[model samples]
Target: MNPFYFVFGRSANMVLILIFFFCPVSPSYGYDPLDPKGNITIKWDLLQSNSDTNDVKVSLLNFQLYRHIEQPGWKLGWEWLGKEVIWSIQGAEATEQGNCSRFKGGQLPHCCENKPLIVDLLPGAPYNIQTSNCCKGGVLSSMIQDPTKYAAVFQMNIRAGGAADSDFDMPQNFSLGVPGYTCAKPVQVAPSKYSSDGGRRWTQALGTWNVTCIYSQYQASTSPKCCVSLSAFYNDSIVHCPKCSCSCQGLPGSKCVKFGETPSLLQQVKDPNQEPPSIVRCTQHMCPIRVHWHVKQSYKEYWRVKITVNNLNILKNYSGWNLVALHPNLKSLTQVFSFNYHPLNQYGHINDSGMFWGVEYYNDMLLQEGEVGNVQSEMLLHKDEGIFSFREGWVFPRRILFNGDECVMPPPDDYPRLPKNTARAASFTLSIIFSPLFMLLIIFAC
Candidate 1:
């Protein structure tokens, strides 16, 4: 009896000590100060979702908070805090699921069942929290859960080498409904017409052709040492003939008379012994002729023409003067008078001494009875008297005058003798006889 009582006493003492050490004295509660051992309580705000329906059976669903340290430049490093204490409201509709417990290894972490988990934060420390759905084949899987509901809150340490908290804000929300619906407008065009000839057309109306009359200066014939008429010839017509006291024929006239036909010849025939049938010949006459002169007085004329062309069709590039011959009728009766443009140059200059005088009738209609040997005259001039005068039935030859060249008849015998000095002596006598006539004109004018 004594041994049993001692053993029982010892067991009772041991039991009391064990109860004092192992049993939770006040519901296993612990305290963590809200501040970092300071006088002020930590201020926090819900950064993500502030309200929830509490429909999920997972911990930390629809949770978020941000803790900010009032002090500047205060940094907090990541450190594990003990498991959180959970509480349930009375009279709430509780599901059959057990109360959410702190997750151990191999168990889906406590936040895995929630859409998002709340993170415990230190003041002024960078942190992040994440959550994922662990259960398969549920409505949560099919529907896109709100990322704000699973976001964690934390304060970022405003210090060097500190990353910003990732789970602080909510992700952009999108609807799971049929992908949301947009379109552009069409451009406008105008109509146009097509041409059959592939060319632009224009309207037509009446137009007038303007005409002008160009007058040529008076021209002298090519015959030598004879007084020729000055006249303007137009379109093969002798329009104007100046009247003067000179031995000049209009179109055609005989330079000599037949010995038997003239009255003087009849008188001479009556006195048969006196040089029987001697003829009284008329003086040589110069017929007016037409000629063209270039405006510059140069044999070569440079014509500069400026054409304002809106449209032009040219087959080939061509440049030069186009000379047209004057009609023979005009050339016959018109006289071409010229003046020297250069004194020393006898070739191109116009000089009174180098005048051209000759008759150029095309048919006997304008010629005297004996003027032309025949009805038709194709030859232009006859070689005679050093003058190379044109004769009856003589034809005009086409000649081109080049620069610095003379248009004289071919020379006779190359060293042909000048007419005898008697002719020159006779010319001097005539000049002497004519000197008084000029003196009288000067005296009359005075």
Candidate 2:
């Protein structure tokens, strides 16, 4: 019954309660700082079934706001709980069919592998085999860009080992087949409803399972894929992208050709079937994509800016490429030439971000390492005098994102600054040396 012990016990209890209330919750493994709520959801719904087989519809929904699945699209794989085989598949097909020699006298199953890898069918698949939202070559657009194209669905006839419902098993070890994506085991979810006859009728699945997958960029690539450069009409010095923004030369996979050696390197014999490696023109910043932002001109009330996205890699062409810029002046955008623009007002009352992409069928496809390897666009924004100023790099973008991945920007101090008095002194000194050289050259020629 000591008073000190009683006070200590109360103090410890209060400390425990504070800790419980103030401790931060751990974020999920797939959490992204840019797209915090981004994740891919895979759903499997049992449609119909016979004694030995069940028809199930598998769907992939991209819930990410800006991230998307692009070229060489998504590949889905899963381990079968039972001796389940794909008797038939629609909207998609198995990459390979393993040996089914044990089955003697009937039609062969579509795939007999214990772990089957499935891929979406390409465009122009036969009508009989196509399902709704099934074939897009696995390309799923981001929800913010195009909501209608963000989901993919495929149905398959699963041949089970037993006849009863309990004997039927769920799939395990689901894989998205794309690196950096980790999928969790399937979990039972409420049945997904379907609409028929134009929303006049509705049907619910008998059973449904869902698998959630998150992406970590570090797991997907060793380095960033893009970088940003800055230039302004007022400053003579162009601030280039940071050195080794994506990667450095002499690294194992960083193979690049010298500026003049690109043609010879391209002519060299290479295996056609093998995937092409990243062969970019030698530069300090070894990034595949370089987005250049230039403050072109200033008018009485409107300022002009030019954005040019260059594809440095010799083999990769970006299809449906998009760029996002976060700048306060974007809200006052008056004109955008040669590219489509969409405002990304992520936070309410904040309209500082805008997405830009090439106009379709014109410059939509940013080609690789040639005359047409880049896409350029111009923007005119009405300046807000209260906050608009060319000093202290205020005209430059706050952030630039290429293809949803944030590009490494030059340091704030490295940004192109307005011409100072010292710049004119250096120019005069250069003129003095070049003037003597010009006279000497004329005398020698005469």
Number of the predicted model whose lDDT against the real structure is largest: 2
lDDT of 1 at 419: 34
C-alpha lDDT of residue 89 in model 2: 94
- Candidate 2 ranges with C-alpha deviation above 4 Å: 1-30, 162-166, 262-275, 421-446
**Residues 29-119, candidate 2, lDDT per residue (tens digit)?**
6575456678899999988867788889999999987777877789899999778889899999998999777667889989999999999
TM-score of 1: 0.13
Cα RMSDs of all predictions?
Answer: 59.1, 11.0
Which residue ranges in model 1 land beyond 4 Å of their true spot?
1-226, 230-241, 247-261, 266-369, 373-446
Q: What is the lDDT of residue 84 in candidate 1?
A: 18
What are the models' TM-scores?
0.13, 0.84
- Please provide, for model 1 over 244-352, each residue's C-alpha lDDT reduced to its tens digit, 9 standing for 90 to 100: 2123433354233533344433343242112122121332222111122211111121111110101010111101101111112212222232211111112233211
